[model samples]
Target: MNTKKQILALVAFSSLFISCTKNDIDIVPQNYTIPDTYTFDRNSTTSVDYSGQSSRISMLQEMGDYYKTQATAGNEVNETVLNNMYSNSGNPFSSTDLNTSGKQLKDKTAASTDYFTLLYGGGSTVEQASVRTFFQTQFTQGNNASLGNNAAVGVAGKYLDGTSTRLFAANGLEPQQVVLKGMMGASFMDQIANNYLSVNKLDAGTNVIDNTNKVVEAGKNYTTMEHNWDEAYGYIYGGDIASTNSFKFWSSYINQVNNDTDFNTLKAAIDLAFRKGRAAIVANDYTTRDAQIAIIKEKLALVPAVRAVFYLQEGKAKLITDNGAKAFHALSEGYGFIMSLRYTNKPGTNNPYFTKTEVDTMLNSLISGPNGLWDIDNISPKLDAISAQIATKFGFTVAQAATVN
Candidate 1:
């Protein structure tokens, strides 16, 4: 985990992210130590105060609760949208589709023209407009503008806000839905990065879908999964990025920017995004692209591969086998998603990991197995502290990260 993210994660899982309401007593803020009932800063998100108990157990419990509640909700929505997207993708043969149709009647058209709201669900139009406006304001004014790279930060802001409703739902504020917002945001950016590096990202985003398919073999539900091109080519032309990796995100940014426009701020945003792209590539200020990529790679190498077991009552079960590459791809894509573009660092321009049918098979196998169900309880808020840990590990948005646990 990066230092900043680590601090946030510690704060989130420490006595700060979760508080005890089962037995409410007079509470006090950590700093004041007074007998106040509400022990938190109003401005601070993920406020936690359970008296003097920095108890790890309590922390885990609280983290679990927060994650499960929000994650389940988000997953329900995510699965629905993904299912709708590939309802007919019994087998997504890119060659066949590209050959048959001039353009696969997909969401690209929608994303390009109506970035305010893709064909997906969960977010309202009013909310999208607000989120778009927020990014616009920030691009021209916020920390990015002050640094002369407001346009660059602008891209991050737009991408962040559009991914999840939870971000803006935070008191109807701009991108305040901290938990799911972060998770979904992480997912989107990760997808972009994976695609940029030519790593797979699709099949992996469906971790919850596997578990939801199990029938308790009783109670259950289900869930796959970018944008940009032209502007991206421009970047490659300008040498901010190679022609290859630059296209996907650059086009996406351009299409997205045009789709979600407030003309007054567009020019500035464009300039800033160009600057941000350069900065990311290792401009004079901040870490260069190479350094950032190295940092991301180091962090990923240290991350533990996901090891899970879904113990179930002995019963009828189905097993399908293939190379574990698919599972690894899914898991790795998720890792990159949560951590940002770091894991995408690859030899040449190719992303080393990504979603594929092989991965889908493994992931489905895991979730469909007995151990899969058990892990639900394991990853449940009552047990594991997945949310905060994921957030800290990946610098994900607080919104979605809070739900992963």
Candidate 2:
């Protein structure tokens, strides 16, 4: 036979050999099929209640406004309002306290259940205790002129004390406003990106199958894996996907990113990634499932990283022009984003891309001077370094990230 004919004959023979062996053994290859689409049952017992979390966040904003109005009017601070705002006893945000019903925010202590305590205290007990103490101190002290103009806005707004007035919205938001904004990216966004959607947690042994089949709770229909993925999804879009309120967790940041065309694409990609991952879980295709999880982490990490770079550049430009107020405002946001880098979940890494030490070092570089940002000259280099570190960690260049926000 000619060379071509010989090669064809050999390939045919090999195929026959493999087929005969399989037939003789009566063995079948593993099924690893991936589904084309999946429908998430929002009412499934396994599904997370994002609307409830959103309500808590809204209550936080209302609490801030209430305190602001009370302080602004020079009215005596009501002890009941303070208790309800900080604990689950009388939440103005919900007719029924979610904490008591074992709902979304349930299991959280009254002292640790409030938005401020939840955001600052969730990761660290020390921070939680400190936040609780801080809240008490602010309210007990009442609205005092000695605390300065920002403090005069309200107890909840005291976090904004010494912050630049330019950071305040034209309509006015307390320091809690910035804190809440930062927490959206830092806490809520991070929880979805890192903790729940983490590949390590998802693919732990047979967790993909076990968790999906084993309903830990008697009444819940969701497997551990299914519930975990839904919880992650809840943090980003919550129960209502169409709503775009500025106070909503992911919607708030999405609105900001939608202003940029490139970032808009990235944002859409995140939505797709989340859906695909959830569907993959249903299909039992671990390969596709983990891939989507990685995509979610990488893209979500970029959101905050890009914003950090943008704010750093904006802050630098404002400082160079001697607009200290705007500079501090921008830098404050940048600081929050920097702090958020520690929450990104990377495969094969126990820790986040950026370490706490690295974040602190960068933060100190920007605000350590006698006058802080005001006295610091040419902070562009420090900002650039931070941007570069984040970019390098994520395998991207600063140029690509700078335009995202």
Give the top-scoring candidate (lDDT). Answer: 2
- The sequence of per-residue lDDT tens digits that candidate 1 reaches over residues 172-265 is 1121122212222222323223222121221133221321231111121111111121122122122123345542222233332233222224
Quote the lDDT for 166 in model 1. 20
Candidate 2 RMSD computed on C-alpha atoms after optimal superposition onto the true structure: 10.5
Off by over 4 Å in 2: 1-39, 42-52, 59-174, 199-217, 239-247, 258-264, 320-322, 376-381, 395-405
Question: Looking at candidate 1, what is the lDDT of residue 308?
Answer: 13
Q: Which has the greatest TM-score?
A: 2
lDDT of 2 by residue, 184-288 (tens): 544565556655665545545556446444444356656667767776776666534454433354555655665676566776777777777776665555566
Give the TM-score of each candidate: 0.22, 0.66
Q: Looking at candidate 2, what is the lDDT of residue 158?
A: 30
lDDT of 2: 0.55
RMSD of each: 28.1, 10.5
